[model samples]
Target: MKIGRNEKCWCNSGKKFKHCHYGRESEQAITKGELIGQSKNIRSRKCCYVPKALQHECDRRIVNAHTVSKSGSLIEIADSTNHVYGLKINLANIFKNKGKLVPEKIGVNQASTFKGFCSKHDKQLFSCIEDHPFNATEEQCLALMFRSVAKELYAKEGSLLSSEVIKSGDKGKQLADQLSIQKFAADNQLGIKAALRELSDFKDQLDGQLLGNFTNNLSHLIFESSRSMPVAVSSIVSPVSDFNGTIIQDLGDLNVVAEQIVFNSFSSDGKGYVVFSWLTKSAIILGFVNTLIAIDKAGIFGALIRLFFGLAENSFISPEWWDGLPDAQKKKIESLIMSGVNPFKFDPKGLLIDDGVNFSGWNIDNIRKINF
Candidate 1:
């Protein structure tokens, strides 16, 4: 006869099956047998995104929702408007090829959807939040997109690690890196949360403020983009030699490096922001005071980095901005790209700077900044 989890042990030990023989049997079944239990409590799987205020009365009909909409192709360009662009990237390849100078091949696009909200909330509340990429004109949209990608990536990475532990019963080097990435992703989530809180708390005071603007006026950059790229791009770093053949495993490293190059346009005293898309391996950095100095700091990698920036700038800003730059600055950037020295070996101290960006327009110069 089959024994229930709460039933007494078949060995007549007067203990619950889960506490005795069944426990050992279950362990053995998981380790030695091919079949594993797939059952889960439906109620336990209910969505967590529902606000507590509305959750109590709502009939939670939970569904797996895509953090980034999956409707469009991974990369697309419209003939009608050359300015609009859409893109997505494979996150798995980025992790698998961590220290490599270049990815062996692009990874298959991974799903960003997860069970997070009920059908009602998913459509009414969550949908609006996820729509930031399309609707937002300022940097807040990037922050929202980053948070969404980071949250989903963290969940997926953890699930993969758990599956590996069950299948191979080993925690290897990959696991260590995965764990580190997971932790940083979690921290990124926290940073996003703090940013949101700051925004919400000071919304009344900072109306009509631009926290930051798009890199190339590519307001339509994410119009048709897949949801998978933000996390993928955020996790990748160039100059493969920087981390001793390992991509950045810490969020702090990512923030510092990105600020040094991509966000160089933002003021040194102001907040820094970065949004990367997988489609073209392009990034948009915001809130920098001077764009030229930032490009200079990229050194030998300036060419590749500038290429992506050029793509973004071309898409958004008018050609006048490019033409407006001093010829001397243009030559300097071109020279750095030609030099071809590994950026890591150059001025390492130049890369280190502020750790986080303020997405909220609230001036907290007098207040202690919140750390992610």
Candidate 2:
């Protein structure tokens, strides 16, 4: 199908084709500066919270709240300078690193932070886990997962809104190039839309629990480590397979809502913990969680490190710990982190499977569950 000369542009610029990409198709399209500026501007937009009711009590100014608390979690991994190496994967960094994901030193205050909450709401809603010690109680688990959900939703919304600017990359191309670019953009937008729907539903449930000081329709798995690993993370991932290489959900089918699980790692009160949280009805994720549980205690740390590197970019690592790793181990970890960023190197089935790496330096001392 061909767009008419006077029809709305395919790039969603809301301008007629003749006035937008008509004659300029043969010329260089949007510059890198414009694209970068527009993208940054889009992500910079802030909101109080997802629920409308809470907006009434929101502080006038939005703050960059840390998904992993600075005082409780990041401090455990920070070095003498109060800094950790966080995985930085953005347009600017990618270009600088030649399409590789590299770990860069980040101050504790800035690591794992997102502009998703107001000052008052950030402190008020997370007081249970932030102000108090982590005991894996219902409230603490709920708060941990809620913060991850909020940050993930904020990121997805930003990506969805960046479609127009992203599609403008096709401006300098021929008709064939334009069609190809627009088609890919269309498919990617569909996936993002589906994710937004699922995340919005989950966030609503969390809102109710946080507001009422109760938990319902939520399930979580807590893995306790008596020793703290020199790493901390907060992220939401939709795993397509379990550790045994069994398929869990077909992520290719955009019509079927993908199963998502919130995974966070942090250390508090002389112990490190890994927590998995999801809706009770998410049978797909429940099976995935069970697979995680079935892993022998000896291999749990390796499996988790793989998952964190393969699926999460919001993770941070201690500089001393990372620099101390052998060259082979560093390359292995870097490869896993790049799989999520570089599509050509991605292998979905290998994400959680045991590959005999046996990553060390952490142990699971106990396991606990709530309403699973």
Q: Residues 139-164, candidate 2: write the lDDT tens digits.
A: 78888988999998988998897876
Clash count list over all predictions: 10, 0
Per-residue alpha-carbon lDDT of candidate 1 for residues 34-60, written as tens digits (9 for 90 to 100): 212211222124454443455675555
Q: After superposition, how far is residue 135 of candidate 1 from its true place, in Å?
A: 4.0
For each candidate, give its TM-score against the true structure: 0.33, 0.94
Among all candidates shown, the one with the greatest lDDT: 2
- Model 2 reaches what TM-score against the true structure? 0.94
Clashing residue pairs for model 1: 216-316, 216-317, 217-316, 265-288, 265-289, 266-287, 266-288, 266-289, 267-288, 267-289
The global Cα lDDT (0 to 1) of model 2 is 0.84
Predictions in order: lDDT: 0.32, 0.84
Q: RMSDs, each prediction?
A: 15.0, 2.0
Q: How many backbone clashes does candidate 2 have?
A: 0
- The all-Cα superposition gives candidate 1 an RMSD in Å to the true structure of 15.0
